[model samples]
Target: MTRKTVRIAMNGVTGRMGYRQHLVRSILALREQGGLDLGDGTVLWPEPVLVGRREHALRELADRHGLDQANVSTDVDAVLADDSIDIFFDAAMTSTREDLLKKAIAAGKHIYTEKPSATSLDGALELARLANAAGIKHGVVQDKIFLPGLLKLKRLIDGGFFGRILSVRGEFGYWVFEGDWQEAQRPSWNYRAEDGGGIVVDMFPHWEYVLHELFGRVKSVTALAATHIPQRWDEQSKPYDATADDAAYGIFELESGAIAQINSSWAVRVNRDELVEFQVDGTEGSAVAGLRNCRAQHRSATPKPVWNPDIPVTESFREQWQEVPDNGEFDNGFKVQWELFLRHVALDEPYHWDLLAGARGVQLAELGLKSSAEGRRYDVPELTL
Candidate 1:
């Protein structure tokens, strides 16, 4: 069996998502597993070259992660100029993604990046056009669909368990620290408007693809957003006015006549089973899917409750739902997608989650912000090549 080693230039590997999800959990894990089996007596190995702005931090991260220090560099332009790098993966700040991707495409490298490919819809679409014109393979991260709970939900939908899909309710969020009394978990840039920050820009893309892939395409959106926390402490303990919206309430109408209501907030306290949950109701059944768990109640098992405020009701409503079993072992969602992209690049396989799909995500985020600004419903236009 022949083994092909593909060198990947991974920028912004020092960031939280880049370091943990892309580098360690996905790439390093793939390397540890002896690369990916190509199902034809061949394997594809990924060699990640970590790139960042700081030399000291980059070297430290490389040493800590057991990566070759020689492979770590602070010079992005120099790395992009390297002909040996076949893929350019970005998990950098959203504002800088477009320029970086353009350079990568110019250097004749395939591209893969985290969601909200660009801050604006035009920029995202331009990136798609540029990549297509350059003839390089490209993709955007849509990790939520690969999640176990969502996969189970997809299975249920494919099996026609839900006779006629009606509505979807998504609850996502938790209280984020302001960095005054307690150290903030997220980066300070996430709360600043000058940077690409806001719950609408950050999460609406996720909602777009999830709604599109599971139920149907989102037709229109009516959204309300607010900066619930006005002031927040920065990384250096300096107070700064948070101009970005921390919470958003949106109502989306799907093409299939399904209504999806999503509430995204960083200020709300968690009262659900997971950090995020989606409860889907259909004519024949209802199911609630968390990050890792899913529970459903079919029409045969569903209980009809009669409203009687005069007396205490004695029905175990939550207990009536049945837990969905994990039929097989589930791998990390990010890792799964990474394998697929690698296969797509090496084997010339068909990959639907291309740059166009990423542009669609950015379009949703842009429209969502517009709806919030105008205080009116905005129709989502179809994105074409």
Candidate 2:
């Protein structure tokens, strides 16, 4: 079996999502597993060059992860200019991603990035056009679809268990500590509108792909957004006005005539089984999927509740649902997508999640914001490039 090493120029590995998900959990884990087998008796090995603005941070990260110090660099331009790097992956701050991707495309590097590829739909489409024109393979992360719970849900959908889908409801939120007392878990830039930070921009991309994959294309969106926490302390412990919307409530109309209501917030406290949960109600059954767990109830097993406002209900409503069994052990979602992208690049495999899909995500987010601004449902136009 022949083994080929694919050198990856990884930008923004120092950030939280970049460090943990992309670097530690995904790329490094793939390396530890002896790379990915291509089914054709060839193994594709991923060799990542960690790029960041801080030399000290990069050096420390490399040391902590047991990566070679020679692989760490502060000079992004120099790394992009390196002809040996076949792929350019970015998980950088959203505001700066477009320029970096443009440079990578110019350098003839294949592109892959975390969602909301660009803040604006136009910029995202431009990136797609450039990558397509340049004939470089490209992809955007749609990790949620590969999640174990969602996979189970997909299985149910394919099995005709749901019978005709009716609607999907998603609840996603967790309290984010304002930097006043406790140290904020998320970056300070997430709450600043000028920096391309907002719950709508950060999360609508996930919703877009999830809805499109499981249900259908989102036809229109009616949304309401707000900056619930007006003032917050920054990373430096100095007070600053939170200009971005911390929460967004959206109602989406699917092409299949299914209604999807998704609530995304950073200020709400968690009361559900997981940090995020999606409930799908169909004609024959209903299912709720969390991050790792999924439960369902068929029409036969569903309880018929009588309307009795004066009496206390004795039925165990939650216990009636049966847990969905794990048919097999599932890998990390991010790692799974990473492997697919690698295979797509190495084997010339068909990959649907490309720059155009990323642009669609951006389009949804832009239209969602427009819906909120106009206080009316905004039709989501299909993006073609």
Candidate 3:
């Protein structure tokens, strides 16, 4: 039995992801519960040092989280120079990520970052390369794969429940109003192009887990994006110019000959919170997974259809895709990945979701952007060794 106490230096503790990853999830799951249960006596406990931009803000954050043993400060230099901290976590916005990460690597620390590794692909590749050379463990927050519902989908696939997967269709979208006037569903930066925010960069990291793990590596992609709502009202009744794409439609060609069609948008009105789901079709059967349900249909399934053109009709087969509740913790998204990462760090076990996995996500986003700009499909490189 090995008990490892890892010292963590949290970067970007002032922002949304920072507060959640650094304060809430990390503190609750790792510091309090001693990481996720790996079915043995391996405990990953984090002794965290909180860092932020402002003194008052950082101190308050540290106090609120009851991080008594934490060294809370606004000094980035001080945090980087500390020898005791084992890992440096960056959940900061994409714009400041490159410079901050470069500094962290120089300090000889393992790294954990949020999606869209850097604002650009070159920076992301270089960051991964540097970490590899430094001989330190690095990973990004790829929380989607561990989602219990999605995990069920993964289990079914690995269990051969979906025989010979043919294609994956992903529907991810929701309606977000400007929180300024009403309650803004998403932050203002999410809609601003200057903030390095968009459907492609923010959401593709999640897709990276789905597309690569389930269907196979994406061979190529072509995409189109649009800013459906150009002007939105802010909290102060000010009109804010929205430049980022509110909707994106794309097609991914996978090496396994399984094509994926994905859509991400902020303009769609749906009765789901952060609507994220996918339907996987196979030769012998098909399956659909959502936040609430995961179900499969075998060869014994029957086909149902409604033949009316003007009325709201429900197909009898639609009810076949039902909900399944897992017998484990089903809390926030960050918490799921938080415990998984700590378990990996604590035990030094084989964690397949490494830094390279995160970089592959950046590659997809980069190529998607290129495809939109060039008006042609681009090839996705083979990454896993």
In candidate 1, what residue range of length 10 has the lowest lDDT sum? Answer: 359-368
Inter-residue clash pairs, candidate 3: 179-183, 179-184, 180-235
**How close is every model to the real structure, measured as TM-score?**
0.99, 0.99, 0.89
Scored by lDDT, model 2 comes in at: 0.94
lDDT of each: 0.92, 0.94, 0.76
Candidate 2: list runs displaced more than 4 Å: none
Candidate 1 per-residue lDDT over residues 131-247, each given as its tens digit: 999999999999999999999898899989889999999999999998999998888888887898898889999999999999989999999999999999998999999999999
Can you write out model 2's per-residue Cα lDDT over 1-385, one digit (the tens) per residue? 8899999989999899998999999999998999899999988889989998999999998899888899989888999989899999999899999999999999999999998899999899999999999999999999999999999999999898989899999999999999899988898899999998999999999999999999989999999999999988988999999999999999999999999999999999999999999999999999999888999999899898999999999988999999999999999999999999998999889999999999989999999999899899999988788
**Counting only residues 3 or more apart in sequence or on different chains, how many pairs clash (N, Cα, C under 3 Å) in candidate 2?**
0
Candidate 3, run of 10 with poorest lDDT: 316-325
Model 3, stretches more than 4 Å misplaced?
Answer: 1-4, 34-42, 233-238, 271-274, 304-315, 322-333
Better of 2 and 3 by TM-score: 2
